[model samples]
Target: MLKRVFQALSGARPGEQLPVLLSFMALLCLLLSYYLVKPLRDSMFLSYYQASDLAYMAIVVTVSSLVVIKFFNHWVGRIPRYRLMSITYAVMMICKLLFLLILPISGRWGTVVFYLWASVYFTLVLSILWGVINTIFSARQAERSFGFVALGATLGNISGAKLSAWLAGSAFKDWALLLSIGAMSAALGLILLAVQIASRDPETARKQSGTAALHVSRGMQDIVSLFGNGYVRGIALMVFTLALISMAVQFQAYGQIDRNTAATVYGEEFAWFDPPGQHFEVIYGLKKLDAAAQQARLKALGRSGNLPTAQIQELSQSFGRYQKQFESRTRKVLSDVYAYQGLLGVFLLVVVARFLFRFVGLRYTVLILPAFYALAAMVLMFPLEIALIQVLLVIGGALNYSLNNATKELLYTPTSEAVRFQLKPLIEGPVMRLGDVTASLLQIGISTALALWLALTEMSQGRLLLALGLLFIAAWMLAIWATGRRYDQAQQADPPRQELDLHA
Candidate 1:
């Protein structure tokens, strides 16, 4: 039954089944670990700081990512691949546990550390994970099976996000519990990975184990030399652009969440209530009483320009209720939005995505999906209806994630094992981090300028968002085209590795 399901969904042969399943499990655990804490990390940060602070955090992520990559390259040089992967996963889990233990003692600094730690952990771990997969699977197998493997990642994301949301909404909302869950998931992924590799015969396993004793370069110059290759450079830019588009869509989606939440609570007229300090009280007071009674109460308060002691006490008592109501309503709204996103991902993976990679072709499929969505996003910004905006953003986000993920792995299949291991860390780690930094800084500058312009000119920022989104998408499309061309050139010049049935 499991084989049938795998075959039906992913077009996997019996020979391809085990490694595919193992890769699926490994990616599932990796994403599950990350998503479990992602919401808490973002929400906690936003509670204490402005969204713009993410720009600073992005800078930290970029710098830290480079150092980690350098150290990672060193490990890739010294340790066997199997031992290195195991140690990396174990150390990451230890970090999570350590953070879990110290969070209570650390206070605000803990939030900072968690944010930075999560960022670096995600980059380093995912790069290594994909590198491992690239090592195990041949190009032919990866092309056929990566989308299917990514289906597991999609499900993992949904499961993890839902679990986090459930725990946060439940009465037993504890950060420690969430961290423990993430740690366990990480450890499970590592075990699965080891099993997958070991399941191969000893001879085959040892041969493919490390970098073939290749003298892989190690240093700041490694990244520079890696990019000197046209194919590697193209993949890096493709990743950068894809990350940029994803970032822009994310920024817009978050804005819609804030807007929709306010609209849900205060109605369309809420914007008018911004400047008047008393409007909130007046609105709440009116909702609680008849207009005549409300007018009478206001008149009484207006005479003294202050509330009576009893009235002040009554207002104070209701404050907690108002705050709780706001929080609950917003949580529900955001939950529904995220649930929609997850469903879109599942549908894409289980239904349309595998078809695209299998039939529609990787290069054009990758280009078309995000390009169309980017155009749709640009068009939809005109109305800015919360529902339409949210839905489109969710769909676009899901497609970009799954498609880019599956195709990018295929790009590494043509490279040598040493190049795959070393170059992947630089691309996935520092290059991707650099993309994030680019997006964050761009978001910050655009937001700051828009805020000031809107304050002075009383203009809408919607058009500005649309313009910038379109600009990023244009660059993204160009990157995709160039990368696809390079991929074709490389494939034509050098044929794929001989197909291997490793599990046999």
Candidate 2:
């Protein structure tokens, strides 16, 4: 019975009736958005925010939807099909304008605010968009075509990132607002989608339309109950772990690139340190004294009266020179890292991702990514090339993402109809965001402390980096073990429980 139910869900029109236009529109909107966001983000169109703000926005949406605003979702579902989709798309348009234009113009909101706007728009609309698709397509179609649908988004992402890269450091920087206008292009595609969907034939017109809709329809209540157990918790935690690795790896890649590439652009070492003006003031951080103070501090290095006056002066000059060299090298390394991991990485990510999910299942497959990440970090520590870190980022930037996203959807498979739609945001969005925030907090703190430690101590540079790498590896392995053990029991079949296993 369950098998038959899934069969009914696999096609746009029960595999009998095809959507001539709506399908195309859906694919178009997804691709357009995917292609634009990357470049917009990396561009000077709105240079004020970081990725965390985006995560925060998503969290806010999820929390609101889960508690105070959940009713809105039902209201959306309650609408007549035509009107329902119209409203969501209309909302999407409003939100997109706000996302693309507002921040670039106002320029007053702090980085956090900017981040929030990006995040909120991304989560709300994207979530709604998918929800609409889920409602429209049969369950089996939901599973298979969802990836194809997502592929549109994926292509958009790659295109956007490439565009941003191609335009980097160009005279077009001043025309950011004009560039912002490009996002409005989504409107055109969306409008096209509406028309196509409106024109598509209704299910009654198709053969086999009377087939069973799907299996194991349950309400949100039972889904919540399932999540209350350890197995579910383990699965959720797997997602959380994956997100952290992705984030940390990105940062690591960025830092490395900035460090290595600074040399090529600004000249050897200390090139990234900037014009040497601010010695005490930090931006988005702490304030310090000016360059004179910095120079004084450098001068004072030999004030311990251990070395001769001539030696001290020589050492100070040499130290400054060394610093500049370091910065230069750092910048070159980082920029290259970004180009490699952030750009070329998409296909690689998809390939490995599909392979793992196809063969290993979401649960077991998820674990292997971190091990790879740990290994990558370990390898980079040995030589510390910026490019190597970018490669590690494949695991760091994409691993958690690839694994967590797959796991969340997998985890929801056996859910009843109501629960599948209703609770997806809470479990996948808010919790996911919270995990991101916490991981960012931990990573920022650890990175800072390590920076300070590295600054003050005289430890071997290679050894210090290696030690940090080891620490991350240890943490990852520990999480993998614990999560596996917790969910171990769920893997086995039980009488009624088998019916509810996410594997289904």
Candidate 3:
């Protein structure tokens, strides 16, 4: 049954089954660790900071990512592949252990540090894993097998998200970090075993030797030369534009959450009541009351100005209790969003991705995400209910994780080893973060301008953001077309091997 299922989903012959299965399991654990930590990281940060603060945090993360990836590239030649992977996992585990100890006492700063580290962690770890996989499989093998292997990641994401939500609501919440660490340890073991199995194949062994021999230059120079290639430039543009649009959408979603929550707790008129620097201060002075009392107080404040200090103090005490409830609610909502997103991803990877790859072809498959983004932009043109925003987030996230991700990884299959190890990390890590920084700066600027404009007119920031995102999507689509053309050219130049026989 297992063999038949593997063959049906992946087109893997008997000889190809073991390596694919091992690779699948390794990726499963890798993503399991990542998803487990993701909610915790977001919840912890948002507990003390506003949603807008993430833009600045993204800047710090981008800078840190550059340093981390540069160091990683330097060691690509010095360390053996499997051993290097193991060491990276070990270091991450140790950092998680430190976070476990430090988070409790270090306050908001600790959360900031973890957030930055987690961003870098996911980028670096994913690049390394895919780099290893690219080394193991021939281009033909990767085309058919990558989707099936990626299924493990989808399952792991679902399991991790569900597990994190359960833990957050249960008495075992404290154990979540430890479990994430254990998941990475398991992944490290599986990765080492997979590398060992692939090394036994003579063709794979020869490929690995050739890859190792090509790593003669300093990693920095190789990265510089990679930009000279038009295909690489196209990929970087696509990645950057995707990151920019994603961050903009995320900021809008978070803003909606904040606005909705404030409306519920404060009053309906307070729904659009976004004060520049006085968000918490305003919340502190306003008591949670019925519509009549809230409206009465709003009128009173408008006429009489500031409340008495004693009254403000009393209301702030009440707001503190409300803040705890707010934090708990925020965590639960984020957990649900991530869980549903992962579930959708699982469905797409299992049912949609393979068919698209088989029938749609690479050029068109690359167009799907931008097309979806265009639809999402249309949705943002109207006032969005919280539930609708959550749906958008889940669907958008699902598409990226499933169809988009599988397609992107396959693009790397035809590249050389130096490109895979050195240049790929730089593109995926720092270049991606550079997109986030650009988005942040844009958000900050637009928001500052809008805060003044909103006083006179009733325009939403989402519409403006959508307009900007549509432009980015256009560029993204063009990049995909160019990159797809290059990829097709590469594949034609050195065609894939014949499909393996099932009975062999």
Candidate 4:
């Protein structure tokens, strides 16, 4: 029964089952670790900074991603695939451990650093994992198996988010980081096991080790040359557009969450207090303030004269509780949102993705994301409640992780090893971040212009985003259609050549 289920889900042959299952479990652990810390990262960052600050942080992330990708590209051919994976995992573990130790003392600065690190970690590590999987499985196998493999990641996402929510709400929230570290360790072990199994097969062995013999240029020239391949350019465009859409949507969703949390904790008139100003310190530092000090600070800030002394005392006493409540609530909201996304992802990957891949074919499968984005944008054009926005986020995230992700990874199966290791990372890492940067700049520009000209708030920028999203969706659709044609042509030209040996 187990074998039948695996075969049905992944189309894995008898000999391929072990590697496929191992890869599944490996990815499960990888994503579990990530999702475990994701809620904490978002909550902590939002606690210290405004939702708008995400755009500035995105710029930092994109720059750091470029540097990291360049560094990783430099060693792609110089290091063995397995050793590189091991080393990357080890380094990440060390960094995460360090982050855990210093997070308490680091304050907002530590939150910023961790947010940036986690962003880079997700893209870089996942890129490497997919690259390794590409080498292990042939293109044909990948189409059938990748969705099933992604099911593990979907499950991990659900498990991690749910666990994080529970832990955050409980007294054991402090242990979440340690658990994430342990998940990473488990992922490393599973990845090594998968690689060892794949090494037993001659074709897989050659594919895995073939990059070592190729010459990799030590400069930007190699990366630049990748653009000469129209397919690579198409993939890059798709990724860029997708990232832009994702980020824009995320910005709106996060803004809503921030507003909702503030309203819930401090009431709808909380904005009048201007918590980002000196009152921020007063509110957060309430624990250290006695009633007299609190009244003094509020009086100095011209905020206490309107309220009665009893109400003032009550508010001051509850201010510390409200701060904690805000953080806790934010964490729970994030975790719940992610958990819903993961659940939807699992359902789509298990029930929808395979059917689509098997029947709809790769070309059309690539079109689903843009269509969904277009629909989502249309829905967001109207003023909706926070629940509606969360629904959109959950759907968008689910589609991206399940159908979109599997299809995107499958696109690289026919590419060369250099493309997988070097060019692919450039596309998935820095290029995607570039898309994020684009979205951020656009949002900043729109918000600034609206504030200056029409005296509109940031929340009013959704109409412009809807228009921009349509434009991007059109470009995304075109890129997918063009890239799909290229993919089909490449497959026909060399059906047996799973990994095209394009010497860099």
Global lDDT of each candidate: 0.64, 0.43, 0.75, 0.80
Q: Choose the strongest candidate by TM-score.
A: 4
Candidate 2 lDDT by residue in tens digits, 1-504: 643553333222344223312443454344445434433443221223332233344445344534422443455335543464456556655655565556545542433354444444455445444444444443333334333344334444444444444444354533332343344345344544644553353532221243223232234553465366554455455545545545544444544443333324333322233345242112211102334554566556446536577866765565455433433333233333344443433453344444444445444654666677566655655556654455566445443333334334434433333434444444455554655555565554444676577573322333344445456555655654554443333333352121143333
> Which numbered prediction scores highest in lDDT against the true structure?
4
lDDT of 4 by residue, 284-359 (tens): 4433444467557755544443766666655555555666678888999999988999999988888888777667
Q: Order the candidate numbers by lDDT, best to worst.
A: 4, 3, 1, 2
Give the better candidate number (1 or 3) by TM-score.
Answer: 3
Q: Can you tell me which runs of candidate 4 are displaced by over 4 Å? A: 202-212, 267-303, 306-317, 454-460, 492-496, 500-504
What is the Å distance of residue 93 in model 4 from its true position? Answer: 0.6
Assess the local accuracy of residue 276 in candidate 4 as a C-alpha lDDT between 0 and 100. Answer: 42
| TM-score between model 3 and native | 0.86
Specify the poorest-scoring 10-residue window by lDDT in model 1: 495-504
> Could you tell me which residue pairs clash in candidate 4?
none
The TM-scores, one per candidate, come to: 0.79, 0.58, 0.86, 0.90
lDDT of 3 by residue, 1-504 (tens): 978987987766667778888888988898889888988887777666677888998899999998998888778878865677778878999999999899878866687888899989888988888888888887667777888888788778878888888877777887878999999888878877887888787767655655534474474685676567777777777788889888988888886675565445544223233334245445633433433564556455544545575654444444455555555556667777877887898788878877776666778888888898889888878877779988999998888877788888877776777777888888999999998998888777667776576642323655776688899889889978878766655555544422211111
